[model samples]
Target: MTRVVIVGGGPGGYEAALVAAQLGAEVCVVDRDGLGGSAVLTDCVPSKTLVATAEVINQVRESGELGVRIGRSAPDSGDVSDVSTDIAKVNARVKALAHNQSEDVGRALQREGVRVVRGSGRMAGPDRVAVTLADGGTEELAADVVLLATGARPRILPDAEPDGERILTWDQVYELDELPERLVVVGSGVTGAEFAGAYNALGSDVVLVSSRDRVLPTEDADAATVIEDVFTRRGMTVLSRSRAERVERRGDGVVVTLTDGRVVEGTHCLLAVGSIPNTADLGLETAGVATDERGFIEVDKVSRTTARGVYAAGDCTGVLMLASVAAMQGRIAMAHALGDAVSPLDLEEVAATVFTAPEIATVGWSQHDLDSGRVQAVGIKLPLTRNPRAKMQGIHDGFIKLMCRPGTGIVVGGVVVAPHASELIHPVSVAVSCRLTVDQLAHAFTVYPSLSGSIAEAARRLHVRGQQAPRKDS
Candidate 1:
């Protein structure tokens, strides 16, 4: 039996440990932090839980605009500000849910018969790991393969480090006992936009700083436009094309200075400047493993590092920096290490979602295809307002877009932007994964008055793109 040792109990490590154990391998997972790793305990789960409360608040705030009577619109017609919010209860629930999820992950791993070591683990050699136990004792273990699933940490600017009080990282934001009076989110990426939208909905006067022309610049252009439009409509002060240079505490609050010499004051500031791979102090060089200049481990499709019998997965590999990608990399590593038929990782089929008000989800090739000329495909876009379900939900923005080969009619890629777009994008993912034809997708049944119908309609338009021939060669 091949012995497998996985470092870091994040989704990648835990999921791979379970797979290795099922394969009849002796699996041991060592992690300094609680089970479920950062994805569950601190970053993704906690943030999403907080966002859930924000979503509720957003819905309630919109009910008035929808003409839905909610206890008779506040007494003050001109001012109209009677809806009060309690942050203490919302924050407590968020932390409790995050803790419960972390515990559940630990319980499941234990039930799988995989040893869960709570400690910081470092490589002693290519195939040996030394665990510094929580109580300070050290334990050495040997394995046929070592999987590095250690996740990434938030990147802080040199001039503006998070003091965890006035300035905060994504993880530290969960510890807040009460909401800030004015929250300034510094970054326009997924994390930045998510927190900006969430806090704004949660009743904080929000100011979003974007170095780029629009928020979520890396996402689909149309989708980004929709989100930015909503942000402005909801009274969010969006400072586009402005990069934050420094953050300093002023009096009881903080002031963020942009490169252009303008300052924005806020009760609290959030640095959403992305993350760096966790590869320090791992003794990776001692084991003959190679890492990039940025310290991310270099691995192939099979998760094999430069050193034999050594593998790396998750954010450490810097493949996609997504938990889902990390989990897949770990499983592929175990399967290949244990003599099972393994397929190389194909990132093209990977689906990514941005959790905004109307979530944006995309899979396979993007609009970059049109610019690069890699694929000759026709694109079709349909607005959500055209859908009956969207009308019922009072959603006027967002759309479903599809791209297909003009000649072959095969669905190449697609993007969905709407409520639960993450879930609605699954069919598009299936089509892309299976390389389904446009006709096949158009034939698929989508319930009427549903968001998914828009996807099918987009496909149908592609199928009939050139159906109308030139009018008598005029």
Candidate 2:
């Protein structure tokens, strides 16, 4: 039986350990943090939970616009103080959920009989890992195969690095005992935009700093435009194409300096700049694992590194840098390493979601690809406001865009910008993965008066346009 030693208990590492152990390999996982990594313990789970509360605030705030106002009698001075945000309670719940998720992952691994070691792990060789245990002891584990799934950490700008207090990383936001009076989210990528929208809904005065033409520039152009418009309309101060040069804490607030000599001051600042792959200090060079210029491990579709018997996945490999992709890569590595059936990962077919207010979920065919003639595709967009369900839900913004091959009508990909778009993107992902045509997707039944019906309608329009007659007939 082959012995597999997996480093880092994030989605990539833990998932691979499970798959390897179940495949009859003796698997051991070395993790520095609690199991479940940042995705479960801090990043995805905690952020979403906070967004849930923010969503509640949004709904309550929007009720007045919906003509469903809950009148409050003239509040006495005492009642006003009692109605403040119970941030301590919210933090408690967030921490509890993070801990619970970590516990569940740990228990599942134990039940699966995978050896779980709490430690910092570094590769000793192509087939060996050296782990420094939590209690300050060290152990070397030999393996026939080694999986590296160490995840990434927030990319801190040299001038505005987080002090873990007034300036915070995404992971450290949950520790706040009170919400900020004003929040300046620097960097208008998915993370920055999402947090800005969430905190704005939670009643914080939010300012979004984007060094781009619009928010979510890497996402669908139309989707990004809608988000930017909505953010501006909702009182968010958006500074586009402006870079933050430094962040300093002032008395009871923080000040962010822009490269353009302008300054943005807020009660707190969140550096949502980006993340760097956690590839340093893991002794990868000794093991012959090749990393890219940016320190991201270079791995093949089957998650194999240049070093024989050594593999890397997840944020470490820089494969989409998503939890779902990370998990899939891990499983792929296990199957390939343990001599099981393995399928090479197709990045184009992977579904991705940004957890913003009206979440943006997409699969493939970026707008830049279409604009640059790299992809020969026809696109159709249908607004969510036109959908009956969206109307019923009182959602005024967002749209669904579908792209398909011009000749064959095969669906290339789609983008959904709406509430719960994350869940709604799965069907589109299935269509893209299976190479289903627009006609096939159009014929697929969707619930009436549903936001998803807009997707089908968009596909139908593509189908109709594809079948249009020649101008000579006109």
Candidate 3:
């Protein structure tokens, strides 16, 4: 039987171990962070759970608009002020949920008969792995195939190190027992935006510092515009073109100095700069695996490295840094390595979501692709304010966008911005993956007074525009 050794217990490594074991391979997983890695134990799961609590607080604050009194008093009693979030309770719940998820993943892997080694793993040779056991011992294992999914950690700036008290990383924030009076989020990317939005909704004064002109610079421009407007309207201060140079403790609070010589004082600062792959000291050179300048593992579409019988996936490979993408890459690696039918990873069709007050989800091509003249397509955007369900829910800031081929009307990509947009983007993902046309999407039945109805409406509008265009005789 083939022997598979997976290094790291993140979504990629654990998922690959299951597939390899089910395929009749002897599988062993070396993990240091219990099970489920940072995605479950610290980063993704913990952050989302906190956001869920914040979402509840937001809903309760809007109870008056729904004609539903929130507290134990009449609507005119101004009971909204009574609605507040307990940071201690929220943090405790986040940790509990993350721990439960990690345990669940461990149970699943164990049921599949995959050996779990509690330690850090490194390449001893091309086909050998040396596990530095958690108990301070070492174990050498033989492998026919080795999968590297060591994942990544938060990128820290030299001048602005996290004290874990006043300054924090995404993973360190869960330990806070109290909410900050003024929270400064120093990054305008998805992580920064999510935390800023969540805190603002949970009754904290938030200031978002963005080096770029707008928040979510990498996302759809229109979606970013809507989110920025919402942030401003909800009392969150957005400082554009401001880059954090350093952070230091100032008497009772923290002070963040910008590159432009301006200082912003806050109760706490959260750094969301980016991440660095966990590839150093792993003996990659001895194993003959190649890496990029930034130390990210260099792998092909099938997650194969330069060395034979070696594969890499997840954030370590610098593919997309998304859990879903990591899982798919892991599965693809296992199937290809074990001589099963498989297809190469197609990044264009990958679906992604940003968890904020009004979540942003997208699949396939983007408006940037169209603007750059990389692809020929026609698109339309429909506001969520026009949707009956959104109006009922008091959600007015968001839209549904659809992009299709100008001639054939094949749905190539789409974006959704609204509450629960993550769940609404699945149908669009299917259309993009299966190469469905605008007519096909429009013909599908969506329930009335639903946010999903806007998806169909956008597609129908695109279909009509396609029909009206002049055609050339061949």
lDDT of 3 by residue, 1-474 (tens): 999999999999999999999899999999998789999998899999999998888777755667767556466652255577889999999999999999999999989999999999999999999999999999999999999999999999889889898899999998988888999999999999999999998888999999999999999999999899989987999999999999987765789999999999999999999999999999999999999999999999999999999999999999999999899999999999999899999998999999998899999999899889898887888888888999898887899998989878999999999988999999999999999999899999999989999999888888745365322111
Model 1: CA > 4 A from native: 71-82, 464-474
Worst 10 residues of 2 by lDDT: 73-82
Per-residue lDDT of candidate 1, residues 70-151 (tens digit): 5556533322233556788887888899889988988888888999898999999998999999988999989899999999
Which candidate gets the maximum lDDT versus the true structure? 3
List runs of model 3 lying over 4 Å from the truth: 72-79, 464-474
Judged by lDDT relative to the true structure, which candidate is superior, 2 or 3? 3
Q: What would the C-alpha RMSD of candidate 3 be, to one decimal place? A: 3.0
Clashing pairs in 1: none
For all predicted structures, in order, the TM-scores are 0.96, 0.94, 0.97
Number of clashing residue pairs in every model?
0, 0, 0
Model 2 lDDT per residue over 415-464, tens place: 89898899999889999999999889989899998898988888878874
Alpha-carbon lDDT, every model: 0.87, 0.86, 0.91
Pairs of residues clashing in candidate 2 = none
- Compared with the true structure, the alpha-carbon lDDT of candidate 2 equals 0.86
